[model samples]
Target: MSSQNADVVLVHGAWADGSGWAKVIAPLAAEGFSVTAAPLPLTSFADDVAALERALERKTGPVVLVGHAYAGAVIAAVRSEKVKALVYVAALAPDEGETVADVFYRGEPHPQAPKLEPDSHGLIYLPPDAFPTAFAQNAKADALAVLAASQRPISPASITVPVGRPLWKDRPAWYLIAEEDRMIRVDNQRYMATRMKAEQRSIPADHMPMVTSPAAIVDIIRDAAAAI
Candidate 1:
């Protein structure tokens, strides 16, 4: 499928919403690719997958599914054949029977990584400071402020569940490693990308490259879409 004929579905990770992909959407749309930033409720693994499916149902052609941060597992859980490619951006990719948390915590946490815990409502939110310190360390003051203000708390149930065989195993997969990320370490990203045998690209970006390095994010997504 050509780029213009493909649909690009972008899924955000924990503590973020569809708006986090603001920088990427316009550029891809301008390239004649129909792009949709699928909103994940961050409620549960199943719920996020269902939400992604609903978004996919609204698309008419082949899809290049992209996931950022924690949404990696969410995108992988989807079984849609329309998803012709998978692009993981500083994202996780747990193998069959492995939980999102299992891969997320595979190695030592970054020194600046936030100490996350469930609040009284059983949801985990990134600390305000974590946005500038770890989540998107390369983001500017204004962007960081907006990110912290618009943050969404993710439910523990979302990461604690075991994922089935990932779609990356069956599709052409690409991984963009955030070399400067403090949330998910570079070693872990390399390990996951290698394990999945994905075409890997590395850049000096923090966890949220879609915000800090939108052009790089757009380049990879464009490549993924073009490959389809």
Candidate 2:
């Protein structure tokens, strides 16, 4: 299938920006697939969704919208007609009337998962140590440093708002479950994948599989695009 007219739009999770999709962009582009990462303000649920909608507007033709962590919620809220498929990489998927917190705190917390309390500014940041242990346990030291330094603070309001019907319900979907993830419980990923009835792949990886297991991410996205 010719991917010339199809674009893959990547959305990052909390504590990260478009840079989170940096490793996957070149390879997808090299494969003749146009790829770009969306920049989200992460100020609130509405703000993030608006940012994603703006990014979707920039891309022409069909789009394979992929979200990681909190961005899963962003992609799900979008009603864009250009999107051909939805891809979740260890991402959160909230249903209608449900908040991100409702699904996130569903199952037993991972042992390494840290308790989060928002700062005085009402934004939440993953602690410096949380990145190495809970976020990307197996990532290289240098990569960890960069991830830690570039962490973005997610507004608490963003996670509390209720979501509408997820985009996954209306479009074909694929999911990648990080088996070794400490941020979102592995069981939760399985439950979500099953709930969405997504084409799912479970791999032994940390939370930030795009950094630790980029190939896996690329292949799943490739498959999702080709199928689309």
Candidate 3:
């Protein structure tokens, strides 16, 4: 598929909305590629997948779906045949029967993720103190504060639910590894990338590479777009 015929849909992770892709959107748009940042409901796997499929249905041509953190699971659940490629940005790339929580707490202890306690309504919100170090370690002070303030609580049930099908199994994939990511370890990222047989690129950044290194992230996305 030609770059002109490809739509790049960016998917944001937990505790964040689609606005998190603000830095990368204009650059991709400038490259003459139509881009849409899918605003995930973060309530459940089904809702998130439905929202992404709705976005995919709007696209007129081939798609390059980029998922960051928890959004990877959402993208995997989408059945849209329009998706021609997948880009994982420090994201959770789960397998056929894997869940986000299962992938995260699979082996070793995650020292970075605090023990989150959900509210009576089953919403899991990160504490204020964990934001600067875990979510946006590479971001500037002002940006980190904004991210923390804008953080939305995710549904606890979304974590353990398994994905029915993973697009990475069929679609070409590229993994952008953030070496300094505290939220998701570098080892786990490598494991997922290897599992997906993705083309890997390492960048010295934190969890939110689109914020800290938007240019680099755009370049990777451009390469993925070119591949399509």
TM-score of each: 0.98, 0.98, 0.95
lDDT tens digits by residue: candidate 3, 1-228: 325768899999888877789999988887788899988888888888888999999998889999999988888788888999999999898887878998876566457766777888889988887877677777888888888888888897778887776888889999999988878888999999999999999999888998898888898888988887
Please report, as a residue range, the 10-residue window in candidate 1 with the lowest summed lDDT.
1-10
lDDT by residue for model 2 over 1-228, one digit each (tens)? 436667999999999987877789879988888888999998999999999999999888799999999998899999999999999999999989899998899888998898898999888989898988999999999999999999999998899999998888999999999999999999998998899999999999999999999999999998988787
lDDT per prediction?
0.92, 0.91, 0.86
Per-candidate alpha-carbon RMSD to the true structure: 1.4, 1.4, 1.8
**Candidate numbers sorted by lDDT from highest down:** 1, 2, 3
* Total colliding residue pairs, candidate 3: 0
Cα lDDT tens digits, model 1, 1-228, are: 325868899999998998999999988888888888899999999999999999999988999999998999989999888999999999999999999999999989999999999999988999888988999888999999889999999999999999999999899999999999999999999999999999999999999999989999899887887787
List the lowest-lDDT window of 10 residues for candidate 3.
Answer: 105-114
lDDT of 1 at 88: 96
